[model samples]
Target chain A: MENVRVIARMDIKGPNLVKGIHLEGLRVLGKPEDFARYYYENGADELFYQDVVASLYERNSLHDIVSRTAKDSFIPLTVGGGIRSIDDIREVLRAGADKVCINTAAIRNPEFIRDAANKFGSSTIVVAIEAIRQPDGKYMAFVDNGREHTGVEVISWARRVEELGAGEIVITSVDREGTGKGYDIALTRSIARAVGVPVIAHGGPGKKEHFTDVLLEGKADAIAVASMIHYDLIAQQQSDMENRSEGNVSFLKSGRSSFGEIAPAGLIAIKQYLKESNIPCRN
Target chain B: MSGKKIAIIDYKLGNLFSVRQACVYLGYDAVVTSEKDEVMKADFAILPGVGAFGDAMNNLEKLDLISPIKDYIRAGRPFMGVCLGLQLLFTESDEFGSHKGLNLIEGTVKKFPPKKTNDEVLKVPQIEWNNIWERADRRWESTPLGSCRSGDYMYFVHSFFVQPQSPDVVLSVTTYGETTYCSSVLQGNLFACQFHPEKSGHHGVGIYKNWLTNYSNNK
Candidate 1:
């Protein structure tokens, strides 16, 4: 059985890691590097860093963060959000990212996917699509972090990217993003079933069953989570452990936490539970 | 490891930086270069490439690295070819169209035929971490994947696999659906695999370490 990749998606706003519902009302958690390190040290299979403002500002600001993580962590790193050109892709790859995820740039110029794939390789070029369900029950692909609709249906765009030479498709449901609700399995499955390349399900998954469901039933090759792990850890810490009395809820069980910051047991637990459900994982 | 210089051939076609970074982490003086002198001067040369075989061949020719790479391998110094690097080492490849390769290895690169198993179609460009087993005839014990158990999962992302003229050169094999093809091959100092060790987690770095230990220029 092929192993399902579990990736930690850290949305970066400048240097801070942030998350929001439906890509609005951003809240800063901490530095991108710290959160990246936390996920890397834990059982996360990969780290995906996307600059929330990259598309809006039209510039990539995650180079330093990608370089640091690439040099330090052994897991594969994917940097996305503002990549607009072949030179930008080269810059990120040379800086040490294993892959680059392109959304707006690729949608603007479909041939860019072929050019980048020809220059670098399809395996390193991932086409990211943000899909929001329409009132007619169809999924339309959105770009610029779900701010604008592209009018192209999600499934067709996924197939087009693969035909244009994208190695993978990362589909994020705009409706379920950062909502702590389960993933939009139908939308993910439709794209996954249509495209031949590996599909990464994102923008949902608040619980372990969500991972199993999307992977097994939805048939996604990987799952990218932000709020599920990041916010869950923050919520668990602040609500349950912060105000507890002595001899309770200490963060040093692993003795590896620095500055009282430690990766929660959530990811590992999800991995274990997934494996128990017969899904193979590296962890 | 510190003194041994491992030059990763950067033909502007693949993830050259990550390959070099893997070597640097193991304390190897790993450098990515296209200069003939730098490639010839290195203790070991790693040819890492991805994408089409014809495009890669064109890049090698454009960069004037063809002679130096062929000469490096002819000299019998330890050399390794990654994915498209491995494909480009064959006699020729039938990808997209007929294209000649470096012809160091006696094989032809081929695209995986559409395969199916248990009513589910297997996808091309098998992009995942799947198990690859070492062949018993020539144990990979002397190779980079030596410590890799029978079913050690390595990161693979490719649509084609090599079809060696002689199975004796094959170091390992992997199965995809109902098809089984050559995954990794070793002919003397020239070692090549279809997978990316740089993306294969810890065992991947360990493979790089093992390869460094097998070579002796630094010592």
Candidate 2:
């Protein structure tokens, strides 16, 4: 199977990166730059820097933050929030963001998706759809940091966004946000099946297993997370294992090399013995 | 003389940066404009869209660009249409009660048929890296369009597809379930692709290169 891309989401409020339930009143975590570096160093494929409060603040200060983080990190960065016009899109791209995500603006205008995609190319324009599953078994799109309900169907919007030349769609489920009860796999699979573009599943995901589930079952191209990595549950375990191991350790245990050893003398002896006997040993 | 200027038609619809970035990557001067004079003056023109075919057509009409665009294409200048751009070239689309398109090509755009089993849904918009088949005789087999070999995955994201009246115009074909849809079409100097070359990554870049170096250079 192809390696699934992992994206770390840093939903920022003011200067601090935060994560919370849905979009109402976020819980501050750490500095955006620090979290960005952490994710980049620890095998994250990309980083999403969303200024969650930009709509409320009525300005895009996230560009400065994204610029700072982009300068420091090597991985791809996507910046979203308060991106209302072509100029705003240009500002974020010029600020070193690899891609610019538009949620509320794209939903409000719909045409902005195509305009941005045409100007920047679809690959650089990401449309973030913050959706929630209605009680009537329909997924509806939300805007204004998932505060305002658009009443537009999520699956239809996914198709529309892709048609508008959005290179990717980032679907975040409000009901599943920060719940750590695994992703809304049904919602993700539906969205993934709906559009031709890559779908980045956001919200839920409490553990690495959740990531695997979304990638394998949900068939998501990319998984975006906040609470899982932010709290250091996943990273801490991997770090602990690394710290406990000595030099040149291998995790594979099935006839493979064991951890905390450069090489077992028995394996070396077997290699030498095979060489002396003119027997080929695959290295 | 050294650099080429590519104008992407801006109809106040989709974002135009993706194409501009692609042009920049190819080391060309690319601009997005809806102005007739600017478009007519460009060395190459790219019409890209992502919305209802009727809405895009309406915008093009409102901008008073229909004649200018037809003139540019008729002048034998290089032009390429992407996704909705490709759909717009068709005669009409079944989206939102049958809307007339730009009618540059003889074709119709229609949605994928519904899935058979209620439990097993057929994936619409056909989003993923699907393989595109090139025509035999090594015609487009050697061009930028050739980059998408059989089984070579190109990104796709759309429900509707172009059904060209003439087989000669069908440049490439991609399979989705039981249907082998038109992945791209080439008619004279005009080229259109259902798949997004900009989002297709290195393969997409190769396509742009071929368009610039081969197709665009020939003119």
Per TM-score, the best of the predicted structures is: 1
Clashing residue pairs in candidate 1 are none
Q: What lDDT is reached at residue A143 by model 1?
A: 91
* Residue B189 shift from truth in candidate 1, angstroms: 0.8
Q: Write the per-residue lDDT of candidate 1 for residues B87-158, one digit (tens) a residue.
A: 888999889889999999888988777546566656677777777887777777767787788788778889
CAPRI class assigned to model 2: incorrect
Clash count, predicted structure 1:
0
A1-283 per-residue lDDT for model 1 (tens digits): 4677888999998988888888887877767787777777777888899888899988788888888888867777889988989899989988889899999998899999999987788889999999999999999988999998787888888889999999888999989887757789999889888977789999866667788889888988899988767755665555655457446544432322321222234677878988899998766
**CA deviation > 4 Å runs, candidate 1:** A231-265, B117-119, B217-219
TM-score of chain B of each: 0.95, 0.93
User: After superposing candidate 2, which stretches have Cα over 4 Å from the reference?
Assistant: A1-48, A55-58, A64-79, A82-181, A184-200, A204-208, A215-222, A225-283, B114-119, B123-127, B137-139, B216-219
C-alpha RMSD in Å of predicted model 1 compared with the true structure: 4.2
User: Which 10-residue span in candidate 2 chain A carries the lowest summed lDDT?
Assistant: A257-266
Candidate 2's residue-wise lDDT over B81-108, tens digit each? 9888899988999986899988889989
Specify the highest-lDDT model's number.
1
The alpha-carbon RMSD values of the candidates against the true structure, listed in the order shown, are 4.2, 10.7
Could you tell me every candidate's TM-score relative to the true structure? 0.91, 0.63
